[model samples]
Target: MHNPALDFAVNKENKTITIKREFAAERPLVWDAYTKSELLDQWWAPKPWKARTKSMDFREGGRWLYAMVGPAGEEHWAVADYQTIVKHQQFIGVDAFTDADGNINSAMPRSTWDVAFVDKGPQTLVECLISYDDLAQLETIIQMGFREGITMAMEGLDELLVSIKK
Candidate 1:
């Protein structure tokens, strides 16, 4: 598949969503794009919805708080609480919709994200496994257009990766 193509799958029974894509960049670069907020801000959100990091602590038990700003200047905040981080290999975290103060929204679904970066010579394979609290929660977010937004974000990442490779 092309770098812009993603293998997106959902498992309602397992309460999980999986997204796989390959980038024409080294594993280290891909890892950095994920771990560093500076790089993340470049491509984390879909076009016209920029990601702005408020704070990032890249460590186990730490948090990365950010907002997805709309073209009209509206903002939606979220927080990722890192659970495990293995440099250049894998990272696991929980992401939840939150207020600007980083308080998790109990009314919304929370998802655990398990991300893996596999070295493939000049390229890297990125896999993201997102597990929700339940099947209903998974459906809820999917119905809310998570798949389309995230697919667009991944494509944005592909464009960034291509530019950085130049």
Candidate 2:
């Protein structure tokens, strides 16, 4: 089987980051993996870190509150508020770092994510456009190893998709 590639792009001028990845699964299955909290918790975080959802409401105007638990049991929380959803096609949301109680942390950069899913025969192409408030915020995330972290997470997703197909 051919492994799909992951494309990550940074646009400092636009204050945005774009990531494209292909999954060896159909669009609907890929969409479910993203939307369902159960599936998300399974592969959302990279290895040595686990994603634990505190609460989730997967609908427009709803939000997902989750924490990334490090190997040492330390936790970092985040919340994503869903702005729009179009079934298996696309979804838009605003994501921000937060406390476990779900209070947004103003010190951290917030981003708006517009994610699209496109069907490619037996595979699904997932495109994510993440926009930040300014260049400083964009640079902050990059400096924080966003590329490497996301790459690892997506690789985890790849393994997840294969296992779920069984």
Pairs clashing in candidate 1? none
lDDT, candidate 1, at 38 = 95
- Model 1 agreement with the true structure over 30-124: per-residue lDDT tens digits: 99889899989999999989999999999999999999999999999999999999999999999999999999999999999999999999889
**lDDT value, residue 149 of candidate 1:** 93
TM-score of 2: 0.98
Expressed as tens digits, the lDDT of each residue in 1-166 for candidate 2 is: 6467889999888999999999999999899999999999999998879999999999999999999999999999999999999999999999999999999999999999999999997899999999999898889999998998899999999999999985
Worst 10 residues of 2 by lDDT: 1-10
For each candidate in turn, the TM-score is: 0.96, 0.98
lDDT (CA) for every model shown? 0.92, 0.94
Each prediction's RMSD over C-alphas, in Å, is 1.2, 0.9
Q: Number of clashes in model 1?
A: 0
